[model samples]
Every structure is written in structure tokens, then in C-alpha cells.
Target chain A: MGILDTSPRVRAAALVAPPFLYALALLAFPLIAIIVISFWTQSGLALNRVFTLENYREIFSSPIYVWGNANRWGVLPLSLFVSATVTLVTVVLAYPIAYFVSFVVAPERKALWLFLITIPFWTSYLIRVFLWKVILGFNGVVNTGLQSLGVIEEPLSVLLYNLNSVIITLSHAYAVFAILPIYVALEKIDRSLLEASQDLGESRFSTFLRVTLPLSVPGIVGAVLIVFIPTIGDYVTPELMLGSGGRLMSNVIQTQFLQLNNWPLGAALSIITMLAVGIVSLVFILLNRRWLRGRA
Target chain B: MTYSPSAAPLIQLRDVHKHYGDYHALRGIDLEIKKGEFFSLLGPSGCGKTTLLRTIAGFEAPSSGSLTIDGRDMAGVAANHRPTNMVFQSYAIFPHLSVAENVGFGLRRDPRSKAEKARAVAESLEMVGLGGYGARAAHALSGGQRQRVALARALILKPKVLLLDEPLSALDKKMRETMQVELIKLQRNVGITFILVTHDQEEALIMSDRIAVMFEGNIAQMADPETMYRRPNSRRVAEFIGKMNLLPATAAMERNRIVVDVAGLGRGAIEPDQAPSGVQPGATTVGIRPETLSILFPGETTDRRLAAGTVDEVVYFGDMTYYDVRIPGVEQPLTISMKNLIGRPVLDVGAVTQVVWDERSLVVLSR
Candidate 1:
């Protein structure tokens, strides 16, 4: 009976309102607050409300006399490299597992297999990382086993407390995310296409090379994006398991906020890292699309 | 039929039975497809027509019996090594490749040079009437275009046999009809033995030179289109192929001509060949095709006998009208198809009409 009640625009707005309001309250507010704080000047023992670009200037350009040389090349790019490496390793390791579960495992057991894959998630994530630390520590199971086997006279110090350990820990932590997308992509492919390839006189390997591999690219790309974006900003894994040699972008930002007590510099660092990550991700996705389109 | 029976067999199956775990997919299939024949395995779903086709294509290995293709025993031969190509029901066109790449996919391991392979792909594409569409992505093509691409892709290998699993089923009605004729022409042009598996009896009749009608994993009747339509071996096959009016009758054999006492059309003598599976001593049924029975227009006369009936149902197609005429003693109405010629008028429902039928057109089926 009412005009607004019957209006499609009002109905659509009503449907969209909940998620939109939630996003505004949770995501946009913090992001805007950080951006605003990045421009405000903060002095020692007190906070100054003076608006200035000094925070951004310090983070973007090197103060030639700065004390910290570790981040002179910028922690964002190094953090990106670590995350990219972890994503590459995780995808390379996860792909075969995903392929095996999707194509090799029997249909009735598929749910059990997938459930097994997600079993690690039931435990707390921080506990999982510390478990990895225990597994790879200097006097950990691996080093102790090697020493007891007479392969080493003492426990080796090369296994933990480094970027390599962090990479291993992060890759293990994100295995499920990488496997799920690839499995879905592989599962979505029509089985008849494989039969068609075989009927067309292609060998098993050649069919995989020509048809199976190409069709599964979308899933692999999805896995890469899902694993890459979050691990770059992952603060806990590197913080608990690594020294400064493995410190990532989040660690640097955290130090600025907590220990150094420079909230403005921390906010500017966070914003710069977010922008760089966003731009790089956009470039990656665009390049993949163009390349995939051209190939197809 | 295009293929001469005396020609060397292209494919042969001897008691080919397939079982998928607990389900019997193919139960003792015995068939021989001659060279250059447009053969179709026609059946409803779950009748194992597709399973039989896959067995011939080497995608499925027969559980018990043996198969031979081109005089070679195909006992352990894998699908990739078999000299047979298939066009899937889904038209399984590779979505990630260009049209040219898809058409040339089978030539990847050929010893020929790049130029020769390219020429072969172009020629195959041209054969399917997709000549200049090589640079286009395969997934971007329309359904008809996709079927054409699938045909070209399968034919590029020049195999001894091409197994098509309902390739035109995905197309719209207009496209399906057009492709059916195109497919027949393509089969003749390539001169390769083509075995199509389809559930559409009309499609099977229109395209196949010879068809194998299967029911519950067994071939009910394998004959040329005309014979399959006119003289089906069983009542089930008769009803499956097209609308057949069946009347309960009593039959007794006298000499070569079997005397049948009918319920609707009156007693008459039918030829022994008309009783394909032999007439039983007890209850029997007589089948007549819709096109074989015609409704006589006012004042029209026929050399054949006549039966008076009332039109119970009238279904009008654009060029033809189907009239279900219930005769005096018949329980169900007999369907008579009348072509809507320029001057011939369409009959009305519940109208009194005279049905024209020939004794020779009746096929005696034993129950």
C-alpha cells in the first residue's frame, strides 16, 4: 500500500544495509583513523594535534643519518618477498595434495580427506606456530634426533630463529587456504574434457599438459592471492619464531607503535605497506588476466 | 543403408558384457558395424546405449567378452592408442585453447612440420565450415559453432571410426536439425565408420543409415531405418521408435501366411516375414505405424481395407496433423498422421472418419 514499501530501490538498499554498515563500522573507521593519525604530529611524552606530512616524509625517504640500517631498503619489499616465497612454496606443495584429493581419492572418502586437511585449524593458530618452533628449535626433535643418530655431535643451531624457519612455519600455517581453492577449480572441470582429450589421441601426460593444467590455473591463482596477501602483513608468526633477520613489515610497524612510541610513523608505515601491497596485487591480477586471456 | 553387408567389418563385438560394480551396464551385446556406415545406437536413458558406445571407443573395457576393430583384437588396448575418435555429448571443446589449437590438438606428436600441421588444421576447420574462425577462442563460440568445432577436432585424426555421443543434443531444435544433415554429409565426406549414440529416435531415424535399437542393455532390433520403423521385432521396439497402434488379437498359423483374428481391424492373413519373431499360438498383438494408417477424406477411396472410427484427439503440427481415431472394437485410438497439404483440410476432434490401412503394413508381434 505504501510507495516506499514496493520500491525495488528501497528493497535493494534494505538487503544491502547490514553488510554495508558492518563494513563501515569495522573496516573503514580504522583505516580512516590510521590515515588521519599518520598526518598528525606526535611529540615525546605528549601528543601534538598539529597536522604535518613529516611522518610520511620519514617513512618514504631515508633520513641519511638514520640509526636503523636493516630497513633502509624498506621493510615492505622484503616482507613481500618473504610472503611471495612462502606462497610459491605453499602452492607448489599444496597443488599435488589438492589434485590428489580432488581426482585420486575415492568419492565416498572425499569428505573425510577434506576434513583431515582442515583438522589443524581446530587448534589455536598461535599454538600451531609455537608447535612449529618446538619442532625446529636448536634442541628440538629434529636436532636431537640427528644428534642421537650420531649424525651430529651436537644439536645444530641452523634450524630455527631465522627467516627460513619463519617461511616454513608460515607455509605450514596457510596450507589449507592454498589447497581449498585449487581443489575447487580442479573439481569444477568437466570429466568429459579429459575423456575427449584421450579420445583425441593424447597421452596421459600430454592431456594433463594441454587440458588439465590449463583449466586449473584459475584455482592456482586464487590460492596465490589468498595466501600471499595475509602472510605479508602477518605479525605473529615472525614475531614469535624469528629474530630481526626474519622481521617482516608488520613487525617494523609494531615496533614503531609500541616500543619506539611513535604512533604517527607507525600509521604512515602501515598505510604505505597497505598501498604497496594493494598496487602489487592489482598488477599481479591484471597481468594474469591479460596473459590468460591471450593464451585462451 | 550406405554400407554393403558383404564389406569387411570395421568393428565387431562378441558377447560384449559390461558391469559397473553391481549394475549391469551392458548385458551380452553382439554387433558388427560395417565400413562406411552411419550407425546409431538408439535407446532411452539407463538402457546402456552410451556404455556400449564407450566400449567400442575403448573408454570402457568390456567386462566379459571380446572386441575387435579393423581385424585387430582390442583386448588390452587403451583409448589413447586406439584408432578411434569421439565427439562427446557435451561437445567437450577445450575452453583454454584457440580454435586452431583445439583442432590441431591431435597432431601434437605427428612427425609433420609446423606448416603441414597448420595446413591440416585449416583443412579440417574448413571441412566443418569453420574455415576462417581459427583465431577465435574456443569457449567464445556459440553452441552450433561449438558442435562444428568438436566435429572438426575429432575428424582431424582421420581415425578408422568416429564415435559421436549425442553431439547435437545440446543444440536448439533448428540447430539440431541443421547439424544432423551436416553430420551425415561430414560422415560421407570422411568415409570413416561413424557410430552415434542418441536417445532421440527421430534423430536416429533422420541421420542413421542403419540403427541398433537397444532396450535394457540388449539390442531389440538392428535394421535399416525403414525396416526398423515398419517391421520392428517386438511390441516394445515398435512403441519406442514411434507411435504404433497395437491391437490385441488371436493368431493361428496356416501354411506360410499366418491368419490373425484381430480385435479392431477384423481377421486377415499376414506374411511370415511380417511376423519377424514368429507368431505365437496364443494371444498376439498387431502393430501399425501412424504414417502407414491414413484417414480417408470425404468420398476418397483406397485399394486397402477400411475401418470406420471417431477421431478422439487431434494434435496439429505445422505441416502435419496427428489424429487418434478410435475404431468400433478397439480399446485405444489409432494414431493417423495426415500431411497438411495445400488443399487437404485438417480434421476436427470427435469427428467420424474412415481410416485407410494396408494388410501388408501390419507387423505381427508375439506377446
Candidate 2:
């Protein structure tokens, strides 16, 4: 007999089957195909169906490919480092704002502040990035104002086309994404818990650190994933702000896929990047679980 | 750790006024609670009982008056710094912690070592009758168990005062009764002042040494439970606290005495001493508790028995029988209750009976 022998069970399975099949076809099947192709080889001017490790060997053997691959490897750790820094800064900055909106602001005015925070995103993303570029450029507004104010005699060359500009632009763009989830988490927290903490003789700072921060971890995790995952795969902000020297893994994948026509190699690099991000996310989930269990 | 027998009032609120925008939440409340008395602020919803409790707990700042604890002014004291704790109505157990951690949360702030904190947590759990359940998560506990954990959390602090905001309202009837008895014993054991806010009059009368009845942002009366129930100062208090059958009456001064002619019961002279402060000679209202009225047999003396009424409905409540008597000329029928000692109901439906209550039971209030 099938597992759905009961009527209710069959009905439930029927209800769930469409979404499950769609996820398998759209998400799981493509991911598996990409992973399989990452290990295959392609011949000159045509596709090779043969399974081989030549692409992997080519990636590891040549000095330029090796250096470029090593540089690609640098994107993983560097992106993670940048993302972590941005996540920390975002959390620290967003918490008090979320706290104020949730606890202090009147219910009517809370929506206004939240709307103001989101208004920046109504403008075009490309325009916002370009605005940052104009502001941070060598002879842009910042330099012109600095020169006019006599802070420096000439425009500073290190202000644009660097890692600092990439981090700054990405952090500013993704801050709203981080704030919304954290604010939701803060709002869902029971006000009685805060009152209980106060009644139990905990100082406001202690209550926030011990109770509010820990309870809002789900929102923090969501914010971290939302900001970090996209920032890792982001090409536009870094491309616009960092110029050619500060290209990330996404830029390299774009070049290999479109410019060089090395479909298999680009696919391999894409799979590698996906695998790296997956591992980091899995580690975070496991760590969060362990911390929660330990606290419990 | 022993308090002096003649120790001063642990909590004192004088002319405390709390105004939220234009609405007055607490109006010029003055109260003093003794060191170890189990005091209750009892009222219906929105009558400022909870506001008064929160003000005493330092959660609110009284607008126009002084609040002191242990003879020290509590003007700028925050809730965390005050030597008091509260058991919230919702229990508010930290869902992320174990029962042990929830109980020991406040104690962990002390300079005690980890072992001392653990011991304190264990002791508190044991005191609340959850001796070996410290490792259980707070969410895993039942409602009554969560209430115990809340009480333990507040009591573990050993504060000078413990405030409870409708602590027993969430429990079922059986659990509520058991918790009331256990709380009284616990208060006696701890010997700390407990100020509770509750809308349940029976719960207040059962557990508190003194009860303050609040009405519309003001304390209408404060006295022992017996006096507050028997000699309520106003009609609102008599109606709000318990079951009272209020009958409209016309008062007249006759032979230097105030005589009130009730609608159903004929004219009876009210003792001038028992008349309320603002009683006029023309119109008034008289309050009588349901239990005070009794059905008299035919041969019984008719001295206090003034009227005959037909029984409209008889409600058998297992321990007592409530009879709704339909008396003539009264808009609302009067209720009378009799104890069901031998499983016998008080009166049959549609049966005519004489309703009698002693003169002392007739509490007259002026309109």
C-alpha cells in the first residue's frame, strides 16, 4: 500500500505536490546539473560530453589560471570578511533604531519612520550606485568641497576605485534590508518580557543584551543572510565603485561566461562560488543551533 | 534579615496622580501598606487598580504626588533599582531559558558564585513545589507551572515588596483555589509585603489581609475584607465587589430617625447611625447582599419578614442555591441565596415565600 492510503494524508500530499515538484524542477535539478557539469570537459569550438578532470587540471596547472583561481579564492574569504563586518555594523546600527521604533515611537509615527527608511530604495539602484560614485570620485563633489575648504590642495586619488568604496556602497545599499527584518523581530517581542526583566532587577542595558538580543537572533540571522548572500554575489556595486582592480568572483564569472566563451570553466567557477556560499551558510545555521541549544 | 515588629510602612503613596494625556488614570490616591501585610487593590477593569500597582512598582511616575518605599522617596528610582519585584499577569517567563534559569535570573545578578546561584534556584523551585523540574524549558511547562515559575522568579529576589498583577486569573478554578491557599502560606513563610491587583472579589477577600476597592481612577474604600464587603461606602462599591440587590427607596425623617420605604419591602426605619455620610431625607438606595436574605417558614415570627414574593428562578450551585424572587413594584427581581447542606434546594419556582433580612443588613446609600 502507498503511504497516502488515508484520505486526509492523500489530500495533504496532493496539496503539497505541486510546490514540491516545482522546487525540485526549478531549484534542485538545475543545482545538480551545474554540479555535474563542473566536473566535465569541453573541446575546442564544440561541446565535449566526456566526463574528465581536464577543466579542473587546467584550472590548477597554469600560472595565470592558478593565480586567477587563487584570486577567485580570495573573493570567498574577502567577501565573507566584508560581509561579516557589514553585518556587525548593520546590526549594531539597526538595533537602537529598531528598538526606538518598536518601543518608543508612537504606533502612527512608527510607520512614517519605517517608510522614510525605505524611500531610498524607490529610486533606481543604478542611479544610487552612480550617485555614490559621483560623490566619491577624485574630482567629484567630496574632493571639490574639500579643495574649496582648503583641506587638501589636490583631489585624493585613493578615495574611489578601491575596496573601501565597495564596502561603503554595499553597506549603505543593504542597510535597509537588514533593518526591516530586525525591526519586525523587535516588534514581535512581547513587551511583558521587557517589563519582567525590569521587575527582576535587570538594568536596561543588561536586559537588552541578555534578553532582547538573544530573542531577536532569528531576525538577526535573517538580516545577515539577506545582506551577506546578495552582497557576496553582487557585481554592480563593486564594478561601479571598485573599477577593474577590485573585481569580485561575480565579475570574473561574468567575464569567463560572456567574454571568453569558456562555458564549462565558467560553470565550474560558478559551482565553486555556490558551494562556498552554501558551506558558510550551513556553518552559520549549525552555530546558531548549537548556541540556542546550549542556552536552553 | 528580621524586620522590626514596629517597622514603618514598607510602601507609601500619598496624593498620587497619574494622567495619561487628558485622561486621568490614577486620581490623588493615598495609601500606606504595612511591612508584611498581603494587601490587594480590587476593582473592575479600567478602575486604576493596575495603575496604582504599577506606580508602586516604579513602572510609572505619579504626576502630582510622592511615593516612598521603606521611608525613602521613590521619585527617580527605576524599576530595576527599586527593592521590589513583580509577577506579571501573563507570567512572562523568558521562553529562551530553562525553568531554573528563569527562576534564578535575578539572583544571577548578585555577586554570588555559580554554585550559590544554582542553590538559590533549586531552593526557589522547591518552594514553589517544582523541586526537580529545573532543567525543563519554560515553554514546556503548563499554565499553572508557569505561574509558579513566575512567582518563584519574583520571590527569589527577596525584595522588600512583591507585586502581583492578577496572578491567579489565568489558572482554572481548581488551580486558582489551590494557588490562593498556597500563596497565602508562601506569603506567611516569606514574611514580605505583597501588594496584589485583582478584579476577582472572592480571591481578594480570601487572600488579602486588607482590600482597597477602586472606582473610576479613585480608591472608593479601603478596609478589611469583612468591613469592605458588609459596610461598603457607596452603591458602586456594593455593586462592583459582590452580588448586591440594590432597591430604590424614599427616605423620610420620622421621629428623629431616617425611614426608607423600599419598593418591594414596605417602610422600615434605618438607624441614623448607619446612614451614609451624605444621606438626604427624600430619596436614597438600599443595598442588601443576596446571602443575607432568607426564606422564613409560615409560623416564623414576622418581625423582620416584611414582604411575600414568588420565586422566579432557583439556581442550584451544588454548595448553595440562588433564588431570584419576583417581588411586586420592583423593576428588577431580588436574589436570595441559601446554603445547600442536605442537598435540598432553597425554594421551588413560582412558590410564594416571605423574604426577611435583619435591619443591620440594610445598607442605605444616598443618590
Candidate 3:
């Protein structure tokens, strides 16, 4: 009679219907549409009613497609490696800053440091990448100044339009992305735990390793996922800093969708990219859970 | 029981002064703690009892003066390097570690192989009565078990002294009492000097061999628990340590005896042979513990001692009965507590009764 006494079937249906409808309208329908279009012939009459693997086979067999696939796979590992290296470097640099902010700086001045770290993010992302370009270009300020100061005889050719340039530019642009989560984790740790660690006969370095580092794994995981996942699919930084040789999967997807005028292949490529990212992220989540469980 | 006293005190704090900016946190404090003694620093919040414990643990360096443990100066020594460990009020168990891991944290740094570490961990766990709980996460343990883990962790290091910062305040009443007895047994078994900081007077009185009563960042008195309860040195200590009835009195010398006149009661002088030293002839306060006062029936006046009063209020605790007696001309009512031996309550409200106490039970306090 009352809402609390509602039947189980009705209650379950009531709880699930709205979200299911929203997902169908927003996500599942679009995905089904893409998959349906990926199998269509040139006439667009859905004549290939039988589900066929031709679209995938054609993309995998062609040389250009193969090269694109190779480039995509190549960028996947390279981007992940670059992101990991940048995360490690950022953590090494940000840890002391975070420690200083948490322990040395007065509470009143902490907001100032946070604001300074966040000020760069307020600027346009593209403009920041462009500024890095101006600074790292052949005739840019860094090369001219180094040449004038007699630090170098010629402008450095490796500073731009390559894998290193993309990595450097992306690292600089997303440095705060790594710092904020780690800072939040450090802030949430109890101060009494530190004192207890000291009172329990642990040296400062040992305490940091045993207590502080293990506790910050969640934040470190977040930082890695935030930087690595996005960087794998990024086209802007690589396109602006590196030319065709450094182009990633996102760039190829863009070309297939717009320049090649092949919607079905583009859809297939998009699905493949999604699958790769999903698999990598799933693996990372599983590993992180295991590590946390072991620690716990 | 054939324990030998150490040649020097296990812990000695000499002329210790600590200041936080302009606020003086600890005055010049000198204390000597013998080996295997259970000492307590008892005070209200902000009374600097915790600061003294922290200073002993080497967490907070004293602003001035010297601290020595076992004849070694503690200057510039960090907490990890000191010969003392503390059980924090919060217990401070590592939520990520298991119960055994929490207990063995201090011993992990020992120069031992993995098997040895595991053995030590098992031993400590067994010592804390949690033998088979090595794999239980700390968060899964109850509060009492967590407290035991903290104790085992501190004791595993074999420190010269163990400091507890209100460690039992987090437990419920029944658990606290159980832990108190267990702690006493553990201390006796371990034979280490244990210093506890607490604001609970009953806890200090029950567990400590000696209690140092602190007030306003200074120690008011220090003595054995019985002496501290019976003869507190100052009015502040008398009020802080236990319940006392303070009555206004004027003192005068008569026949070499110290005479005192309570406001409502007639004048009486302490016998010259039994008078305290420095009993000046002037106005003073007389203090008597509530339990020392006895109620007598009407027409039961004694020769020189009994005082008659009307019972204003009676509180019936399960174990004891408390009465607030208002005598004529006395501005404040006198409190008296009697053990509830009989099945019936002692007196009804508004009943007239004579209150009597031994002359020696009265403590005359100077301003």
C-alpha cells in the first residue's frame, strides 16, 4: 500500500528505467549506429544484412591502413612511456613543493602557492603550447640566446618537430595535472600518523618510504591515469610541436573522418582506439587494486 | 620481588622550561622517575601535562633546561633516537597495516632476517593476547584490540620508559577499567617505567604509584597517591585532586595551640602537639574530604566536635549516599558522603542531623 511496500519487480524497474533510457539515448544508440554504419556498402542500403568482418579485414590488410595502424600502435606505447616518464619527473619535482606547502609554508600563504600553480591552467591550452613552440623553435629565444651567450654554435635541431618536442611540450603543459592530485593525497594524511611513526622508532626517511609513499598510491595512480589516458588520445600537442612523423592515433582518426571521406573505416578505427584505451585502463585498475589490497 | 634500584634515576628532568612564543607552556620543572615506577601527570586540559610527556618522549624539545635518561643528556636527540616511546591518545594505528604488522612496526628495523622478524611479530602478538590475529587488518579490530596493538608496538622496542598520552580515554567505562588492570599486570611483567598523562583524577589515583598534579603549566604537588589525596599541598591541588568542602575560618594562637573558628560552628583550637607547622594566627580556609564527615542522630552531640545542620539535598548513588548539609550562619553547605551499607537511605530531605568529623581530618589551608 505504501511506497515502502512496493513489489520487488516494480521497485527494480523504477530504479533502473531512467538511467537505462538515458544511456540508450546518449551512448548505446550512438555506438550501435556507428557499428551499423561501419558494415554498410557504398550504396548505403544496408545490403550486407549478414554481419561481416570485411570492414575490419580491409582496414587491416591495406598498406596505408597498416601503416596508420602501425603508427597508431607506435604512438600508444610511446605516449604511455612519455606520460609515465613525465609523471615520474613531475612527482620528483612536485613532492618537495607539496611538502614545503604542507609543512613549511604558513596556512595563510598556502592559498597563494596553490593559486600560482593553477594560474597557468587558466590560460588557453593551445596558446600555452604555441608559446612553447615560440621558445623552442630554431630561431626562437632559447636558440638565439644560447647562441649569443656562446653556449652553442648552431641552433639545436632536436628541440622541435619530433617525439622529444611533443613530450617536452605536453609535460610542461600538464605538469599541474600531476601535482594537484598528489598534493591532495598528501594533505589528507593525518599529522598524528607522522608523529606516531617517529615515536615508533622509525627514522624520517624510513617513515616517508613506509608510511607516506604507500599512502599516496591512490593519488599517484590518479595522476598517471589522468596524464597517460588523455595523452594517448591527444592530437593538439603532437600536431603543433611535431609534424607527420610524431602524429598519434588521434591525428589519424581525425584524417580518416575528415580528409579521407571514409565514414565506415573511421568508425571502425574509433572503436579500435576505444577498445585499446579501455583494455589499458582496465589493466591499470586491476594492478592498482591488487597493490592496494596487498598494502592493506 | 628482589628488584634492584638503578644507580641513577631512569628519567630525570631538571629545571625544564618550555615556551611557545610568549605563552609559557612549562615552568621550571624538576622531576626524578625511578626505574619500574608507574607515574601519572594529572591535570585539566591546557595544564601542560601532555607537553611534559611529549618532552620526555623527545617529540618537543624543551625551550630551556636539561633532560637526561639513564645519565645521558637528551639534547638535540630526535624521538626515534630516544630511549622512550609513546602510546598516543588517538592510538595512531596504521590503517593500512594488519594487527601483527602494527605491533611489529618498531621491530621491523631490527637487524633480523625475515624469519626472525616474523617470529618477533608473532611473539609480540601473543604478548598482547592477539596470537592468531596476525592477518587481521587494523581497521577490523575493535578499539580495545587497537589499544593493545599500540601497547605491544611500544613495548616491543624495549624502551627505557613508556609514555601514554591519555591512551585509555577513548575506551568505554567497562573496557577502560579492564584495560587499567591489564596495564598494571603488563607493567609488572615487563618491568619498565611507565608515565601516563591524564585529566581523569580517578584513573591516576587507581593506576599510578605517584601522581604529579599540574595547574596553569606548573606542578602544584607531587606525592604518593594516598598522600596526594589526604594532604594536598595547596588549595588548587586540594580542589583538583578530589572532592573537598572548603569552609571559611579565622585562626588564632591560644595556649600555643592554633584555634580556628568556622563561620557557623563554635571556635576550636588544634592541640598544640598535633598542630601543623606554620599555622599562622589569621584568617584561613579549612578543607575536609566529603567522605570523612559522618552524620549523627539528633541529641547525639559530642563534647567538643559535633555540629548540627539541616539536610538540604541527598544524592543516592548505588554505592554511596551524598548529603548537602546547610548549617545556620554558614553561607555554603557542607557535603558529606557515606557508604550505602544499609538497604534504606540515610536521611530524608529537610531533616536535621548533626555532622561530625575527627579533628585531625581537618586540613587548614593558608590563602
User: TM-scores for all candidates?
Assistant: 0.93, 0.91, 0.90
Q: Highest TM-score among the candidates is held by which one?
A: 1
Instruction: List where candidate 1 sits over 4 angstroms from the true fold.
Output: A1-22, A39-41, A47-74, A243-246, A294-296, B341-345
Segments in model 3 whose C-alpha atoms lie over 4 Å from true places: A1-29, A39-51, A58-73, A90-92, A294-296, B1-7, B268-278, B297-304, B343-346
Question: Model 3, range B1-367, lDDT digits (tens) per residue?
Answer: 1124443478889989999999899999899988888889999999999999999998899999999999899999999999998899989888878888888888766998989888888887788788898898887889999898898888888888999999999999999999999988888889888999999999999999789999878888888898888777767788988898888888898776788887776677665433223467778887789998888754445654778899999998978889999989888899999887654457899998888867677777674
- Output the lDDT of residue A20, model 3: 92
Angstrom error at residue B185, model 3: 1.4
Candidate 3 pairs with clashing backbones: none
The CAPRI category of model 3 is medium
Candidate order by lDDT, decreasing, is 1, 2, 3
Full ranking by DockQ: 1, 3, 2
Residue-wise C-alpha lDDT for candidate 1, range A2-75, written one tens digit per residue: 64677898888888999999999999999999999899877886767789999878876763212236645446
What tens-digit string does per-residue lDDT give for candidate 1 at B13-113? 99999999999989999999999888999999999999998998888999999999999999999999998999898888888889999899888889999
lDDT of 2 by residue, B1-367 (tens): 2234465787888999999999999999999888988899999999999989898888889989999999899999999989889999999999889999899888755998999889988999999999999999888899999999999999998999999999999999999999999999999999999899999999999999889999889989898888888878888888877899999988888888878888888777777645654578777889889998987655656666567789999899888889999888998889998887653546679999888866667888773
Residue B332 in candidate 3, Cα distance off native in Å: 1.4
Error of 2 at A15 (Å): 8.2
